[model samples]
Target: MALSLCCAWISILLLLLPSLSHGGKLLVVPMVGSHWLSMQEVVEKLSERGHEVVVLVPEVSWQMETTQAYKVVTHPVSQTLEELDNSFQEYVAVHLTQKPFPLNALAMYNTSVHVFNSFFGQCKDLFRSQETLRFLNQSGFDALLTDPAFMCGTILAHHLSLPFVFFMRGFPCNLHFAAPQCSSPLSYVPRLFSFNSDHMTFFQRVENTLISLLELDYCNGFYGEALKLSSEVLQRDVSLMDLVNSAAIWILRFDFVFEYVRPVMPNMVFVGGINCAKKKPLPKEIAPSLLNCGHAISLHNVCELEGWDFSFLFQISLMLFDRLMESPLNLINKAKNNILNKNIRIKLYLRHSITSGPRRVGAGLRFKRQILAGSTI
Candidate 1:
């Protein structure tokens, strides 16, 4: 009876499999940045998996060409990303050389606003373009995947009347998104630009609070301009905050271990180190050393020693034990199993496995110290 029931269950699952796949026409609009490169990887992967991926990108000089993997549609952007990049580099160089200890909050705020304002202006032009309008309505896209770097994608998704998923590179700590949607408390979870650790002193908390307030002020002022401009372009009334709050899902590209200990809602999912290659060929320089070394030592994200310059025998590999976010509930469940159970199926690859045994010192002590020292307070 048990054997027959198992066979019957398998038959039922096989019969219902066609209704399970969630692949469809996905429209992606990513802001240009090194951080936004992860979205490109996602678009390629989605296209490989039989989903029709369409990207509407800024027609910048440095932008990649449209290929067979995905369809690319470009619109003329007013501002150049080169100028923004140079300005950011100049800001970093000045701050890093002159005053590295206490971060200049004003300079950071000004730089961010300057960059975002330019990008937002370009997005405004893109939306106003007739070509962009034709695509948005006629594309027959099933879902929207966008990077909320400047919230232009958010506005576009809302205007198009589509369910959108935010592809955030990391948690931005925006009060509009994190506080209201995720219930991320300001008391513990520090704002992105605040430069404070999760564990904070009394005064640090006060600083965090002040930073959050200033950010709110800046966002309100800046988004007011965006609201008026967007309203004019779309020929309709809309609330920016309301659209921001309506995000169906938020995909954060960081692990819980790296983040502060805080509550994250079900909609907020973390997929850390997903961009890392599954199987990377060993570098020729390092490959020879690994063979000669009697005992193979595996390091985690430690590329260079603090004081040593010599070629080291240590091989680094980043491994994380966490749930990855994916569409289609059944696929996500199966993928999670594959991730966790891979070690069992792959034997020879386990030769480089770091010991699972308990260490003499506390786990992740070095990482903790580094994080603590790096933070403002």
Candidate 2:
């Protein structure tokens, strides 16, 4: 009896040992705005799983808030919140108004440069602070989690000599695939901003190859300041690709549904639809109206609707519908007028059939009546 009790106690201790030793301290360096939203979910989950998470943010930031899930450590920065907001607004304005191909691309590139410059200014301040550096050095973090949309986290992870993982949709110029040594054939794998599909024609393939050649130069110019800053911080010559290649793992925020068929590296893990894990209920004011509407159209890009010339879309809808409404033109006019006046920017959903149920038209309206009527919002 005594031997059996001792053996049982030993077995219990062995089982508990693994759980006790599993948790580790993690340092998270996240990007601002929408990027942070998805990354925040990851931080919270890590905390819940018994790991200690420390989120590093700038003194003046857009939406990097303090929370119970992780400890927040803010560093001093040169730029203010107002400057960041203005730069983003300017970018949006240029993106919305510009239409010509190369001209629009040029305008966007210029605005993005200004925005990244502002972010780099803050990064410079982070490295300048001896106090912040000292704290990080003493923290004894096991690993780092960061969004590689910007270089601050990548540089910092290297400075700290910590094993880091990247959590992002992807990097521009197909650097994500290139850094991982993943196979990306130009024949089918389209270059960024090339606007070519996976299945390309003979001429399109030539265009893709040309763009692929330009990508290296484009990335170098785009991240020129970051590369310089990285060299200064690390006291070594480091290219952006070198920094990207150093990541121990890549937590991609997409799955096969969103991405085309391609070769992925062993280190890459896909966790698509992570953003939709937590869904908020519809607003009380709009829920009932949305549920009652039968046929709704969800417009994702409001900028595309700015011109209010939907004659082509109306024609398509007419073909989809079996029978036209009493006044098709009037319905279109009312939708345009309502959208202009109300400035509705929410996602709208459309039912499968026009004859099946009630028809209402407006912007910023969402419907789940057909597909998701039984599910909780």
Candidate 3:
């Protein structure tokens, strides 16, 4: 069956990954909430394939409405040298560069308020110090694939010369747009000013100009502060914008169901659906949503999907599970059915309903190991 073929490929990919690990540490940083759920899907498969994966994430992520199964390292977010560099334009003005300094300095201070500000200011000094360089060099990570939200991570990646992969949690931000068009406007950015006079309607043009001001101010702040040491130490002007542009990767974490997906680039992939498999199985109320998704959630398709192909399958199935779990009445009846399992044996196959075939095999393997190790027959 197709399920059997998929299983074989998944096993092949997983087996291949350990060889790639090369006896080195595998560190993964997953984003919060549904993002974490996506990471969990991959982690479970990887772990099952015999690779050890340590999840590093913000401490507060677990407390949110995640899938409630994955265990991740909960660390406080840190401000990295790259971020300090973002606002470094101020430092750059006072110290280095001789290109229209005063006007740029004024712009830098104005853009500081509209950013993804956080409590990381406390560790700013440490991260920019030599201590950070030493820490990165000694972390012993062979490979790192993390979210772009953390500047410290990317900077650490750069300092250590370790290969790093970045996973973008939302739509990729273009050169001019900080926030998505439908989402909350980045408050610090004034407006985008990239458009010419005939480009758009008045309101859109105004918004664009405002976004542009924010970006310019952001650039001014960045070139001034973050790279100030460059002219003095390394003899150059490094900007935050430049550093961000250089991040190794940006993996989008959304379903193709969303509107207006951008064209795929070499560094950016449409892995929009990478976390939907039942490597386990649907919860009590998820069957209907699977029904709603029409034909995507098939045991045959799922069992047979292997390697990178499963990423798309997981995305669709995960979305359906999310949609189904939203119904209260369905949840209550699922509970009732479980309680009435004795009377339902003649019809619905309740015991096998929630079971995933591959996981059952995993479970069987574990049991066989235990029995083989037993002292008694």
Q: Least accurate stretch of 10 residues (summed lDDT) in model 3?
A: 359-368
Across 132-251, the per-residue lDDT of candidate 1 in tens digits comes to 888678988888999777777777887788899988764233743453455556788787656787788999898888777776566666566567766775688856566577888888
TM-score for each predicted model, relative to the true structure: 0.67, 0.76, 0.43
Per residue, candidate 2 scores C-alpha lDDT tens digits across 300-338 of 354556655344333333333322232132233233322
Give the clash count for each candidate: 0, 4, 32
Regions more than 4 Å wrong, model 3: 1-24, 30-35, 49-52, 57-115, 122-136, 171-213, 216-237, 256-262, 275-377
Question: lDDT value for candidate 1?
Answer: 0.61
True-structure RMSD, every candidate: 11.8, 10.0, 19.5
- Supply candidate 1's per-residue lDDT for 366: 14
Candidate 1: where is the Cα deviation over 4 Å?
A: 1-22, 61-65, 94-103, 170-173, 176-180, 221-225, 234-240, 278-377
Query: How well is each residue in 1-377 modelled by candidate 3, as lDDT tens digits?
Result: 99999999999988878454334465665544345556566666665665555565443333233333333444444555445444433333332322353344444334433232332232234344564346445667676666544344444455455676766554213431232222323332223223233335666656665655565455444334334433333345655554455555566665433423234446655466484443454555655555566422223333233333323333444454454343221211122111111111111121222322221110000011222222111
Clashing pairs for predicted structure model 2, backbone only: 296-349, 296-350, 296-351, 298-348
Tell me the deviation in Å of residue 233 in model 1. 3.4
> What are the lDDT scores of the predictions, listed in order?
0.61, 0.74, 0.43
lDDT of 3 at 275: 49
Candidate 3 versus the native: TM-score?
Answer: 0.43
